[model samples]
Target chain A: MDEIRIFAPATVANLSCGFDVLGCCLDTVGDEMLIKKNDLGEVRITKLTGQDLPLETDQNVAGVAAKSLLGELGSKQGFDIEIYKKIKAGSGIGSSAASSAGVVFAINKLVGEPFSPEQLIPFAMEGERLASGNAHADNVAPALLGGFSLVKSYDPLEVISLPSPAELRMVVLHPLIEIKTKDSRSIIKQNVSLKKAISQWGNLGAFVSALYTEDYALLGRSLQDEVVEPIRSILIPYFDDLKQVAMDKGALGFGISGSGPSVFALCKGNDIAQNVKTAINEFYKAKAIDFELHLSEINTEGIKILE
Target chain B: MDEIRIFAPATVANLSCGFDVLGCCLDTVGDEMLIKKNDLGEVRITKLTGQDLPLETDQNVAGVAAKSLLGELGSKQGFDIEIYKKIKAGSGIGSSAASSAGVVFAINKLVGEPFSPEQLIPFAMEGERLASGNAHADNVAPALLGGFSLVKSYDPLEVISLPSPAELRMVVLHPLIEIKTKDSRSIIKQNVSLKKAISQWGNLGAFVSALYTEDYALLGRSLQDEVVEPIRSILIPYFDDLKQVAMDKGALGFGISGSGPSVFALCKGNDIAQNVKTAINEFYKAKAIDFELHLSEINTEGIKILE
Candidate 1:
């Protein structure tokens, strides 16, 4: 009971038209955290692997999130945390969220689950703040709660877990390129025309309805982003071309995942997902760019205990 | 058949967060039209009742819509049209849509229904142009297709019919004050901050999801409209007070319906809808303003043949 291991999955935020609101978890790639009691009464990252992430408790997202949870719990109990990072940093697949959500999820379990999943969001968002300058929960919510999550409001931190269709599959391609979250976010305009905003909201409504009805065609038609994607997609190399190739290959919908360098295409079945992956691989191969492709069913169980 | 009769239900457009994209039909109020063939080879309005709507074909929404449909059908056949309007003009509850949609629906049937319900939208929207000077279909689509409708796109004219919850009921209040569509629209800002747009889109996504899953609580929570309501509600007297009363009386959600003077509240059952209606009536009575209240279930059948 004094030690626990938790795995937090990668997440796709935005989902094209649902910027800053919608996100879903991925089953194939994630981060693992091992938490063990320590005598020093301090929360610390004792070990790290796969990437050169900060070891400092204050600087690390996992540490920050754990510290926030501990601060709320008013517990001085010490813990040594080991992070086995599988989701790559700057891959735009919610790497920081996996870390932040992983620690709090593990800590909550170790402490007999004092906080509900919704209650755990602010703590994870605090960790997200350490990783990125903004305290946003689009990625962390899904990574912590499993399946699709909507950050309906951030001020009071209202997160809703949405239903995931059984037939849904995802094809994510990480282009092995780094795109700083802050830089990608800074490029977006502060104001948008009311016209485009209306169009975006309409698409978002249709997209959410499609998810509930399991109407894949409607979902595909609603996967458009006329606002954020148009501006942010310019930062990614061949984003337009990649999206076209994915759609032409029968992806129900495709768009930049999170902030970019990683793009995801959703499909109805595994065969189409494989086809999309191959098409994307062929495109990247033609350009001789190293890329990683992960084909997965939606991770309905966002973070889970590791046996 | 030498003649045909059709009824087009009234609709509530701009369902809060969905502004200009979402709408639903009402069962209790609508417009009725009768079309009879003649040898004159001309479309003419032979009779009008309930309201003094424009009789000239170009000036009338119903007449304009009928002409648009007939032009597409390449039918030179003459027709005498009779209109019996029950939905009040400038009520902000798709009065024009009921008229416009009624004629197109009647003519489509009289000519053997050459257009699918969806295909009839543009012609109906053409009718909408005669009324609003803009070819918008938020009201017309729902009036034609029944139930709830989302105008997903306007360029290629994509309209989606959303599933309406069986328990959903509506209470619409017309305050007898006129707010011109142009004036109401002119009051809104052309641009909105990205922050507000994100919140609006999130609510929109949640609202649509709620409709499909029949999650009444979620639907109520998602009925917020920070973008348009804040600006337009100022035009309606006691709008804030009426909305508060409706919510207090167990209405799921309340907001200005389209360009106001009229406001609608959604409730889970007929009893709550009646309670909301009584509350609204009390509010108007206190102010000594003449008002009309209509309580009804959502019209699942938008336009229907009058037997």
Candidate 2:
């Protein structure tokens, strides 16, 4: 196949209790990308719409990601790419991850599928590096592998995909604001108390078990972040009020998605998610803020073919 | 049910990568107890053998645990307890936990079981509180619930029992040296770098997943301790050498069991465990250290009825 059209789904990273190690895919929100092979021996972003991003190969997450994959294989195979962005940049819902993971996924398919979905992760992570200062796997991993993904280790780059409960729904709230990855990360302390660290790991362990057992309440109880959230949540507008409302609306758990500007309320079923979305809307609407709400089921499949 | 004789299996707590929250029950290393209902409305220790311990109900761990269970139930029923101590007190394995969990287990059985085995955890933890200053449930939870247990929280006191692979075995090396839990704990820094904490939680999250999947190799990789081991291992003699030989001889993972003096090497099968045990034995014998070694399978039944 010389050309491939695909849907690169959005992802929620920096999960509560899980912090930098866990992420889950979103089904309803994503960007559409079209890639076609070119014999010119060059990677280029020929078309870009919906959001104004750089067209330079090195500057664009997709271009960087696609080049990483091609460079790894030593293939002179070039590709012309077009990204129709639906998920806005700096929304903190893995905007760059979608474009990055999406391009590598599409190119791998175009090049006779030399790499499996899981194998495409490292190249996708290059996009993450270009987007965020760190080459963290949390966002790109779940975006490629789908479901709930755990980054077991970083040196080896081992990521394990966990099974998501059938009824799990994510209600995402994005306020029209930008939180730069650098500035957002700067506020967090370099050190944490061991007491809080123990609590975080215990909750993280229980949270993983909850995923296996599909214990919704247990999952909610384990969705606590003792390390980063207390400091970073202040950067987002009304983070506390939103979390309180989400929990009161019977969300299984709630936390800042990635670094912030986007928040997710994890619910057991679509009905509760819809209710959470409605409650969050009504609560946030009262404030002088423009926000968007999305209710989505856990995406079992990561990226998908559009045509 | 007037007279009950039981085997209270020992447990390995403060597992690698797990630290304060994880533990597993052992099959062969434990203590035997004979508990009998008394006509007098008072708890008493009629006989104690194999070790010098306090006989007073309040001073004895078994007595404290038994009393805690009775006090919670508000039952006037009393019992005469006999403990034949086998597991050494400061061996890092759950010695106090065995005695503490055993009597409550036996008394519960004698009184037609007012509480389930899992319910007996809190009372058993009272014994832990008497033995140590903290009422940590890592040891006692597994001593009651069997197999592997994760102490999800200390405040609300939630414990989760996890599965163990069929062939899993533990080779425990109790070097004939005593290191008090308080002294062992003091050396660890109350604060840790965020980078190390992230690595710890990442490994812990993966370790929990490994338990569910019964992936032994993955379990080996996940058995890492960045926060506690470096400081604590200094308390144990030739700690690095022993771990090296155990790993070289094909043990799945190795680390300090609970605190110090006693270390455990986790192996996948009986054959590998035996090999690891032999290697460790040989390594320790050359040194001027006197040690006792025990090889045990994962005890799915925490406390057993011997007769």
Best-matching candidate per DockQ: 2
Native A-B contacts reproduced, model 1: 0.82
State the iRMSD of every prediction, in order shown.
Answer: 1.0, 0.5
Lowest lDDT sum, 10 consecutive residues, model 1 chain A, at: A151-160
- Per candidate, the number of residue pairs that clash is 1, 0
Q: Give all candidates' CA lDDT scores.
A: 0.89, 0.92
TM per candidate comes to 0.97, 0.98
Off by over 4 Å in 1: none
Compose the digit string of candidate 2's lDDT tens values, residues A208-267. 999999899999999899799998898889999999999999998999999988999999
Sum up the clashes in candidate 1.
1
Candidate 1: Cα lDDT at A256:
85
C-alpha lDDT of residue B143 in model 2: 90
